[model samples]
Target: MTVFILVAGAFTGPHVWRDTAARLAEEGAEVRFAALTGLGGRPGGPGETIDLETHVEDVVAVIDAVTADSGGEIVLVGHDYGIHPVLGAADRRARSIARIVHLDAGMPRDGVPALAAVPDPRLRVEVAERAAGELPPPARDAWPRWGSTAGLSEAALDGLTALAAPQPLGTLLQPLRLTGAVAAVPVTGVLCTGNGPGVEMLQMMVEVGDPALRALADARVAFFELPTGHWPMLSCPAALAETLIEAASGGGRRLTAADASRPPAHLRPFLLDVPERARERAGNTDLYLPDGPGPHPAVVFVHGGPVPAGARPTPRDWPTLTGYARHVAGQGAVGVTLDHRLHALTDYEFAAGDVADAVERVRADPRVDADRVALWFFSGGGPIAADWLTGPPAWLRCLAANYPVLAPLPAWGLADTRFHPVRAVSRAGRLPIVLVRAERESAEIAATVEEFLTEAARHRADVEVIDVPDGRHGFETLDPTDGAREAVHRAVGAVLARLKG
Candidate 1:
């Protein structure tokens, strides 16, 4: 018997698949059901972004555990927005996923949110009103022709009602970023036709008409259709199970336009083919223009450790810390995160004018709004930030540090004399300097820095101290933990606010 991991669509928990699981079992296929976080029993954790990432992680964790016990690759079937998590999960664990089936689900496209794939105007409006609440309606009717159901039975409606749940706002709003890993996975689509009854009718008449279902067919994903309504698991469980088994079998049939129309929305590949003009420079700097439009404000994100090594952007780090850059642009500001040279970015070099040169370079970029240039740093980069403040470029508006290692510590073999926080503050010529520190950090370490700031203040320096709750060193480092990211967000926010002001 083949093992199948079934994922339910947004707003639904595993309970929606009870009948399907039973039917699959009867057909000799071992079936397991899944519910996404914020939808099923899984509750949202503190500071959770309430976005696609949370949902994707939920499916990935489940698949990893299931595949471990199955001792081999397993078939993963997704329904509705469940396809988002399934495709993303497949990217990370492709080896363990043998076949992926979209059960009346939308496939992943770069930049397109799952909700954009829905075809019905009324359904789209309902999903949007439930999500953004304030989004204005489109000028044209967005509904599709599919699921113009002949009808459904009262009993089927009753069953669907027993199964449906309120979907989360985040599920519909968050955008999915597809990588090459998802593109390579073999996929199959199952489309349901004809209306069943009650909740089943609503599900078919609304969800089956989604543009994503048809869009999947255009991408050459294998497709099959069932002449039943929305809740086929309830109305035609045996038939849906048979189709799944057939798709799982070696030869999958092709899908037709008669099946579903392709969605106008398409995923642009995620990899940013860095242009020749944005080439790696100075043997230490790495530049990036994150996906999406911009006359974005430019801020250089100086990595804390490793020269040039700090230049390479880690995928895990990009979504968290640098998310602020994207946020800034969305707020109508230009944001640029950069890699600074590790060895030469010392107090002397920073003071000598490297900071000013970098700021000028950022201003030179046409995409950057030169008036909004700032410097953001973390840990080891903190001192560089201090020096930049002390000797900033003509256009540098502000500087912010996250748990900066500015407190003089001889343990690392660097004298407090060369990297004096107080001295750096004194040199900034009174530019706005924002310092954020973790409340949980050692008092001795933070106290020394505070004393320096106090001294700087006595000398009339523009310094703002924000004590981040439960912060730690390198708080800007994005981890699965909470407070760190929020601290980074707060720090980035401060820098952006000062520049925009």
Candidate 2:
């Protein structure tokens, strides 16, 4: 007999699992709903008293009773804020659990509080400062603030608001500590596609060489995708229950880690064989100077990534960036490349500061024409274009994106306005923007480019598009066809013309 324990997230209790738990039981599985303290009909005992530990004990008590009677391991499921306590309990009873399910939830790291779960960094800080001990759930109309309301009906949302409880500040503020014991446990991730990134997107990032994301390739980790939103239990209980059953049975899609021996796409040789020019390093930026007697226009290439913090041959060293810089220099313009702290999605603001700083340093150089400069972004570096779109400077002649990700993906984090080029493009006014689109681009990325184009059109933003129908993302090294080569040539020429004009 399979045993399953369901733990609901913040502002919710076991009640939210009623339909799903019934479905599990009907399938001949013993289902237990872990009623958290201060939630699920439990009273909020005191200010800040019902923290992560309080909820952990609540879950552990259920586990102890079930295992004592059956003398067998059970599948443990955690959703949203509930995952925090579920993990805390799982760590203590690692041997008692068969599989741990991450249901539309972020992987909580050790020492990080659930506060990081808030998505938008700026709003997270504000929420932290205003909370004394407990956090009241948002109003009925505001329930969408916490999670997407995609499939929820008006009546369902009404019930959600009515049954919600005050989430204790401690539950989010307290740090989660792990013993490394849980790593040995088999895992299943139920990715809700409508709410955020699905497994496909994660695998794409992994293929690009993010060491931090390599854990997804673990053989013990399996995945299932739901065509719903964050609260899958409430939105599509039947489908979610079925997925949960499959997850408990250790049946789901498994990802293969890319071969370690081969170099990542970025490190591969440049597609075009351009003569190498001497490089000069000033702080985090690298300069490829043309053989000219006077100062020349500059094109700064911003490489994409939330690359692993320790990645070697940094962006500045990547063959892709170096190739572009050298090609730009060969065209009689200075090619500037820089390393930024975009080690994670949250570091965009920090990386933007690095990009801004590098521009200053490059502009100050005697070899560069400070008044004529263009910025080109690649891959994940695309959103940084927002900063220049709004009130572009006189010296900022052009902005270009190559297979750029113009928006934040679902479930990765909050949709911070800081990096959304689609919303900020209206302010771009008459500033020239060049877009290099890939027909075989990832769905998530292509969607963002489409969104930016739609918004730019509505606002009449001055924009030009160059299509690479035969190319994929990172086409330079990945696609060696003539189409990819010509697209690259055209994109560079357009940006160069803007700088020279």
Residues 180-292 of candidate 1 have per-residue lDDT tens digits of 67666678877664321122222222222334334444444666667654456656777788888888874455433332353211111211222222223332233445445
Taking the tens digit of each residue's C-alpha lDDT, what string does model 2 give over 1-501? 788988998889888888889898899899988998788747764444777888888999999999988865599999988788888889999999999999988788889898888765665787789656778887986655566766777777888889998888888898988888888889999988766666766775777677767899999999999877788888999999899999988999987788769776666788899897999997899999999665999999998888777777688988889999999999999999999999887788899999999999889988888999999999889888889988889899999999998887655454756788988898997889999998887656777899999999999998999999678888887887888889989999999998887
The estimated TM-scores of all candidates read 0.43, 0.87
- Residue 435's lDDT in candidate 2: 96
Per-candidate clashes, comma-separated? 14, 3
Task: State the TM-score for model 2.
Answer: 0.87
Using TM-score, give the best candidate's number.
2
Q: List the residue pairs that clash in candidate 2.
A: 196-410, 196-411, 197-410
Error of 1 at 412 (Å): 65
